[model samples]
Target: MDFSSKLLENAVYEMSQLPGIGKRTALRLVLHLLKQPEERTNLLSEALTDLRAKVNFCKSCHNISDTEICEICSNHKRDKSLVCVVEDIRDVMAIESTSQYNGLYHVLGGKISPMEGIGPQDLSIVSLVNRVKEGEVKELIFALSSTMEGDTTNFYIYKQLEGLDVTTSTIARGIAVGDELEYADEVTLGRSILNRIPFENSIKAS
Candidate 1:
């Protein structure tokens, strides 16, 4: 695509770098922003800058936060003993929307995908194991997507917690195989969480 202005070209290029956004879509977005008031564009730029500069990850669960700990982790009413394991903040938001779980969460950052060069060490598995070993978490709910990498990550974590007192479970197959939790409907995700089964049973079925 040719551009008359380098500023517009740069804006579209940056916008296109976001996932699922193409150059055409990015160009449209940049044009729209250009049409908006200067103050509105400044606000958008400021928000993005602040997000990148000031955002923090929850010390406990690693969810994006403004403080050291996220509101969910700091909430006293949440079930600290029941920790839901997920890929990232998006999955956390998806599960939270269901309102079916009162448990805390542990964001693994990502699943173990050899094709993507993402291994067990690339995630927060060690911190999770430490949380289990500390004896505060009584049960772990594997809430990763229903993909091979998700299953592999779950199994790896399960093995790490071997002989530990904590119980392990995985969301039910209500979520289709290879489906991401973030894309599932709230009702289905809620039911899956409510009907989670033992990790050992899932392993056997696989």
Candidate 2:
């Protein structure tokens, strides 16, 4: 019969629950944490404990924030007429890092994945539609991932915004197919944004 303490077993189990972490990695982490000073372990515990307590979603954009509205949404320097709709907060960080865009952001929180049981209702789509309906935005940029799920989500958003005065478009297809915006480099992402194409507009033989 195994005699491992329940606390240690619980720690390993919780760590293993994180994506990409397995039993072996969790055990290694637990062992490493055990070797750390009490202060280190305490710090980790306190940070995790305070994560949900300190972080709040921005009411306007659904981005993680400490205040009611995220700094990006509140900033007057940002271009209020343009809203970049992305899959998550990570994409916001990626775009911000480029220092090329001056527009506001709307984090959808996730893509529409029917198989995964995630749909527009599961995301911040309603808030996004409401924000656009306010009529301040002149352009809507779809900065979602290039995957099938991302495409599905973008199309859903497009249909929702149909007939709005706002012009809709997406970042150029320069980004590799299936490559997530967060994992893409700054130059590629910046160029992709700079070279965005208009939605429903086509260049045909004159």
TM-score of each: 0.83, 0.82
Residue pairs that clash (backbone atoms under 3 angstroms), model 1: none
Kindly list the per-residue Cα lDDT of model 2 for residues 86-123, writing each as its tens digit. 99989999999988899999999899998999978999
Candidate 2: give the clashing pairs: none
- Give me the overall lDDT of model 1: 0.92
lDDT tens string, model 1, 158-191?
Answer: 9999999999988766788789989999978897
The candidate scoring highest on lDDT is: 1
The 10-residue segment with the lowest total lDDT in model 1: 169-178
Off by over 4 Å in 1: 175-206
**Each candidate: what lDDT?**
0.92, 0.89
**Model 2 TM-score on a 0 to 1 scale:** 0.82
Candidate 2: where are CA atoms >4 Å away? 1-3, 175-206
TM-score top scorer: 1
